[model samples]
Target: MNADAVPGLVAVLAVTVTTIAIGTWGLRFSRTTSDFFVASRTVNPRLNASAIGGEYLSAASFLGVAGLLLVGGAEMLWYPVGWTAGYLVLLVLVAAPLRRSGAYTLPDFAEARLGSTVVRSACSLLVVGVGWLYLLPQFQGAGLTLESAIGAPRWVGPLIVGVVVLVNVMSGGMRSITFVQAFQYWLKLTALLVPAMVLLVVWLDDGRPGSPSGSDGAWSVPVAGEGAIGLYTTYSLIIALFLGTMGLPHVVVRFYTNPDGRAARRTTLVVLGLLGLFYVWPPVFAALGRVYGRELVAEGHADVLVLELPRLMMSGLGGELLTGLVTAGAFAAFLSTASGLAIAVSGVITQDVTSRFVGERGPTASVAAAFRLAAVIAVSVPVLVALLSTNIGVARSVALAFAVAASTFCPLLMLGIWWRRLTDAGALAGLAAGGLGAGGAAVLNLVGVEGSGWGAALLAQPAAWSMPLAFATMVLVSLATPSRAPSHARRFLVRLHTPEVLEQAG
Candidate 1:
């Protein structure tokens, strides 16, 4: 190993050890099934918000955004903006209502609202699909981080991070990870913030330098694309990022841990602030990269800018220490986010697949056992895929996950919460339409399909079209089959929309 790699390797080891230690500490609280699933639905807004920030700011936010900005320029700002604004959309529309649904998972909400096993099963499949899709990038990112930090083989990072996350999830489930994630959020923020502050001081100490000469003029443009194609791509991305948060199985699952709808709303409010604060630093790193690390952009290694910038700007002990700090944060990003996704997917699998064999009224021990088994299965598939699949831009891959979520669950959630006339038939139809559209596009992209013109643009960003198609299909199908609507729809809506105070008084 290179001498310089020692700090990074030490940082990775420290983070891994600390994560396991924290998870084991949390195991003391993870006795019952409820404790395993949703922290017994008692996480306060502040703590829950911090945990949300930890998991939600995945590899995409930590590394991909700055890299994209370094190469793609100001237009990439939309990624962070849309990501943070997503919580805003959730706060206003979905958070409180979703919490009030009294469902443990998205599939639970689907079944409760639509009163159909078929709808619930379809939702379960989608939750797993989206979870795995999102987890893919997290795993891939782990490999990239390890490769950049310590010259470890790329496969080493994914396997190590995956195993660490699995151990935590299997040990205590959501309750265990809640503490771990909450701690990681602050660590990630500090990891990025301190280095950024020091770099800014260094830049000021030197002159604030301009972009390197002969840079592409397009790099300065804030818009991602030009003309109609640019506008379409930008809007499609915005649609996905803004609406997709409510549909992300991991993100939505966090809401279930809140004590009530009111607390869920409060949690989202705090999350918005926390996310906004965290996002401010990535762009700073991108701008600094333009000055100090422009060669990384040319080398197509911009993803490592956050990890590399600290060492480049300073040398000796300080640089190595900062490198180690950011490396720790990057590993935390993979672990925390992967842990959340595992919990969400495992909950669905335990409920839908494992528990069926055990019977619905099985002992709590049986249920927890099923959850642990499902956690292993939930994480294993993604690790294998990350090992075999071709690497893509982490942020772009995550955006596709968002698009899929936007196209499928976003419609299901919005109408399911606000529209009483929605029926199982409508939900199923909308899911198929949106899922096939966006998912097909994603698959094609994954297989290295490429093209130009509007066809390529549409495939690259399907949300603008697919999301509307889903909403329209759901509405039209429901209107056509009013008799198929759930008899309990109105009652569920009442529960969802009613303030907790009113429900308590009643």
Candidate 2:
């Protein structure tokens, strides 16, 4: 191995060992099925908030944002802005009611709300779809980070990350991951924050050079220079990120870990603060990349800006140490996000697929065994996909996942929580419409389709049209099929909106 790579190698190993050790420690509290699934619905607000931040800030946030900003300029800032604001939307609408639903997964909420096995099954499929879609980027980003840092072959990183995630998820599930994720959040924050501060000081000392002259003025503009297509794409991306947070299966599962609706709301609040604070630094990195690492953009390697920036700015020991710090953060990003997705996907698989074979009333050991088996399958499929697929930009790929979630589940959660008219037929129709619209777009993009027409722009960012299509389909179908509405929806809404104190008093 290159001596220059030693720090990165050491960082990778340290993160891996720390993750597994923490996961193993958490295994002690994961004896019950509920513990494996939702931490027995007892995670406090601050702890749950930190865990949410850890899992939510995936490789896309760690590496992609700065890279995209470096290449695409001001338009890409929308990514971080929309991502942070998404929680504000979630806080106002979904968090408390979702927790109050007493459901372990999104499908549980659907079935309870609409009272249809078909709707439940559809939801189960969507949950797995979104989870797999989201996992693809985390795995790909891991490979990218490893390749950039230590010259590992592209495939090695994904395999290693997949295996590490599988071990953690299979060993202890949600209860175990909660502690692991919370710790990773702080690690990730420090990894970026410290380097950014040091880099700023260095730049100040060196007399603050401007970005390369070859950079386009358009890079500073908020919209792409493609006129109508640019505006449409920007709005679509905004819609996806703004509404997508509540729809992410892993994110939704975190809310279920809160003890009650109030705790859930509090968790959302803390998460907003944590996420806002974390986001402030990526742009700093991106701005510095413009000054010191313009060649990375020219060479089509902007994704490594975070990993390469510190070493480029400072020499010798200090630079290598910062490089190692960011490398560790990037690995933690992959593991934490992948663990959450695995848990969400595995829970759905165990409940909807594997449990049928295991039998529903099986012993706790049988259920846990089935979940472990599901976790292995969940991690393996995505690892293979990451190996086979071309490397799309990590943030862009993750945004596609967000778009799919927004088109499908956003409408489901919004209407399910607030509207009494959402029938099983309506919910199913909305899911199908939204899934086909957004999923088709995602698939096309994944396979390397690209162009500059309106058609291309639509496929590139489907949330603007697809989300509205879903909401309209749901509302229209519900109006037409009022007779099919669930009888218990009224009571369920009361339960969702009522404070625990009010319920207890009555």
Candidate 3:
């Protein structure tokens, strides 16, 4: 069977066009800034759950995880489990309080909680930086998936995604994005599931049961002499993913979009279920690919397992049709996740910078114009990086971003919301220490330093030490700078702790 991508590309574009139409239509409902930012805080838990799932399942989940599992054997399963369970940690620690804080962005919470414009500005910059870093893989993966499945040039996927994301974001903010993400979630799941079922049956019919004919070590086996290092990586990664959810600007922002704290918690639980279900399929792809996709490994095309499965398992027109379906699904993955990230980052730009233009220039188009400009800046850096770089692993890059999030903002948020002793100085010191620790390590990795064992331990799991350093720095600094603390510390604590139903706005 041969794969021809023309039909698949057409199908993907058609769906993308329909998605745009739906989002544009939703613009009528976005009447205020609050609506644009948090969907006016009215998104129901179920719909919000699907949207969260859609946004969370990026190219990493759709392509990288299965590819890693195919290449790394059993060790890669940790990525999905850790990712899904991160929400559980979010549920227990930050979800309700974050929602009740009435903050639109992370910076909003920082200013309201810590009473420091400097801190708010720092937080906002970090939000944009982290958001863009996360966005790169979505763009890169989109390009790779499209080229492999449809035979287009590398830039086509990212260009398509960038355009779609900009349109969705500019047409309607959170209100429209909420509906679009929910729809994309189901579209993505069906895209993968239907093709997977078909491919599995075809492989079974050919009697290629376990390891793709003659490839010996492709089963659920540990890497030779690397078990201990792998275990350390697994535990540390779990720690990062578990605690990191509270700090991710996009994820945290989503909770605030829910109507109430209870609804926020309920939304998280639903996300856990949806993410859990989505994760089950990736390993299946890896395992099945082991049985029928050894050729991909030999060809160094492991990432194309989901895309190439149809061609390998079937022949003739049936193969082409299945390839088209999988291509559409893969494109859906890129478009949905990229759109979500763009919206989050662009919102920060609009709120922080564009509002100033409105007050200064007296221009009627300031708000919308600023947001569009911000969207360009937010997506451009990541897209350029994606085009320039070639060595970073997909899962590793995403995890590093998670480590940065966990180490820096996690401490500030946990301490700010729950600890009354948290002061501006403390938060600042912690951010510096953790940002240096995690960010430095990530930079080293970016420069292509390969270290295993203790060296690997430092680079692979900096959060284990960096997170503690941030927490200790915050505490000790708070003690030393007690007088610099927010004057309304007690009042802020009361507000953050108050039930949404019982609270009165001050």
Candidate 1 segments whose C-alpha is farther than 4 A from its true place: 211-223, 357-362
Q: What's the residue-level lDDT of 204 in candidate 2? A: 84
lDDT minimum window of 10 residues, candidate 2: 212-221
Please give, for residues 1-506, the per-residue lDDT of candidate 3 as tens digits.
22376767776787789779879988889777677788999999999999988888888888888888887776566678778888998898889988888888898899999999888888887788778768888888888887887677788777788888888888788888888889888887887788777777787778754753222453333332257665566667777787877787778878988999999999999999999888877777787888778788888888878888777778788887877877777777777777777878888888888666654433425666677777887777888888777737666778888888888889998899889989988888898898889888887887788875678777867887888899999999999998998899899888778886675453
Pairs clashing in candidate 3? none
lDDT assessment of candidate 1: 0.92
Better of 1 and 2 by lDDT: 2
Top lDDT: which candidate number?
Answer: 2
**How far is each candidate from the true structure, as Cα RMSD in Å?**
2.0, 1.8, 2.9
* Residue-by-residue lDDT tens digits, candidate 1, 346-464: 99999999876664555777888899889989999999999999898889899999999999999999999999999999999999999999989988887789999888889989999
TM-score of each: 0.97, 0.97, 0.93
Q: lDDT, candidate 1, residue 182?
A: 98
Give the C-alpha lDDT of model 3.
Answer: 0.80
Q: Stretches of candidate 2 above 4 Å error?
A: 211-222, 359-362
Q: Rate the local accuracy (lDDT) of all candidates.
A: 0.92, 0.93, 0.80
Clashing pairs in 2: none
